[model samples]
Target: MKTIAGILFIVLGILTAYQSKQAQPAAIDYAKERVQILQLIDTESKAFWDKDYEKWASCWAQEPYIRTMGWWKAGGVTVVKGWEERGPRTKQHMEQHPKPNPQNVRRENINIRILQDAAWVTFDQYGKDNGEPVMDMPGLSRETRFLEKHKGKWKIVYVGWLLEGEGN
Candidate 1:
């Protein structure tokens, strides 16, 4: 009798542990999605530096909210359906700019944080403005981005660029 009871308890413990682990798919998915968002940002940085506005912007969701560096100009996500929404704007922006992009910049050392319905990301970006290599940005002009999962896809809702000791 004692041996049977011990075996039952052990089996129950194992089952509980297995159930908990199996229930973590959402968490794992959230983490993966967060990484993909950051990767998109990285790709966009390349697009800007390389003068590929379309490619740079392509990383965003259909209608993504963007907070470019300086000047708080807000943009809407017109690419709601699919490629049709993006192809035109991307082509136009690239045509107007015409290669040899001004940014030609690179982002360094990025970190991301995932929350229930939002996320925070920080990275170092250095580039040139009008043929002058812009430098000396300390190491913490981090940008925090707010993200929301829409229809099973993550999109940026808001973003703010700031440094330590700045705001709340």
Candidate 2:
């Protein structure tokens, strides 16, 4: 009876560990992969600053959405929806600023809660613009994005950003 009970306990333990593996990958590997995803995002934001639409759009997966407090609201669509109007609006914003600092770079600190074939990401960005750190309603802008894995590659499906403490 003792032998039987001991064997059962070992089997159950092994099975439990194996079962948990299906939903979560190793933490170290997941963190590294998420860091890579953020680097891709950094490249994308730089393209936006340059107004390089092709490169900017390439940063996202095939179909992506950008929704922010001032950028869009209520079912906004596409990477470049109404871009004709957006260009001038962007120019106006740029006019308010001097040349950005060469060392300035946009950064996103992403904390991934789950990153298997599918992932949930929470992120916040920090940086200086034109030699001054951005100070909006929130100390730093925050965003949450969702990515899906297909054919072993992760693709971002959704992106939402806003200032914390500021209602929108």
Candidate 3:
């Protein structure tokens, strides 16, 4: 009876180890999702500075219900309800503002947290604007963005910017 009990214990131990090994793939999948989200953020930044409106738009969800909100150092909160609302405004804004030359944009101190199909991201962005650090301008800004997965792709769902010390 004692020998039989000992064999049962060993079998249980092996089963436990196998279960733990099965758990690892979830972690690996989460890490891969995090990396993909980070890459999407990088792509968004690149598209913005590159003046590629199409690419910039691609970073956002194409759904009719998908909305975007942005707060700037100078401008207060601006909300775009849907693509119809965002499209013309974005186009006009891009047309008005000149694309950064030499693409001196920087993304720093990025943190991403994944929660199931959603992710929250925060980052510091700084770069040279006319030979001066953009951070030195009116406001040093830290940005937070919310992303959601749709059709196996992560898209920016919301954007919030917090500004400190004003400049221009």
Candidate 4:
């Protein structure tokens, strides 16, 4: 009876181990995903600064729940929710500001957390306008971006920005 009980315990332990392994999520390819995410970020920024409304819009998810929030030292806080409100406003802005205001921004201290099809990213950005450093939002500004992958493409779902010395 003791031997039979011991064998049963071993079998149960083995089965439990197998079940646990099966229940675990698969490993993510962080390196590949990071590269893809960085590329998407770059595309979005370039399109925006270039005032290419269509291109910039393509980087977003186009979902009703998407949002953009900002806290600026001079302007205080602003929030734009839903694609219906954001899309037309952004398009109008792009039309009004036809000239390109290319930004020379350097992103640092980027931290990205990826979970399957969703990703959360945060970073510090330092910018220079033309040859002079941007003093209005001096130092590093805080930025956060949330993205979701759909149909094999990653699209921005939310963007948050807080200028230096603001939102503290």
Once superposed on the true structure, which residue ranges of model 2 sit more than 4 Å away at CA?
Answer: 1-28, 64-109, 129-139, 164-168
The candidate with the higher lDDT, 3 or 4, is: 4
Root-mean-square deviation of each candidate, in angstroms? 8.7, 9.6, 6.9, 6.2
Whole-model lDDT per candidate: 0.53, 0.53, 0.71, 0.84
- How does candidate 4 score on lDDT? 0.84
**Which model scores highest in TM-score?**
4
Best-to-worst ranking by TM-score: 4, 3, 2, 1
> Compared with the true structure, what per-residue lDDT tens digits does model 4 show for residues 1-168?
999999999999999999999999888899999999988998998888788899999999999999999886567887999999988988887777677778767899999999889999999987543422222344567999999998979999999988874233
Off by over 4 Å in 3: 1-28, 98-103, 131-139, 165-168
Give per-model TM-scores. Answer: 0.47, 0.48, 0.66, 0.77
Residue 56 displacement (Å), model 2:
2.0
Backbone collision count in every prediction? 2, 0, 3, 0
Candidate 4 least-lDDT 10 residues: 129-138
- lDDT tens string, model 1, 10-99? 999999999999877554465586667776666655665566765655555555344333221123222223344544655666676665
Off by over 4 Å in 4: 1-26, 130-139, 165-168
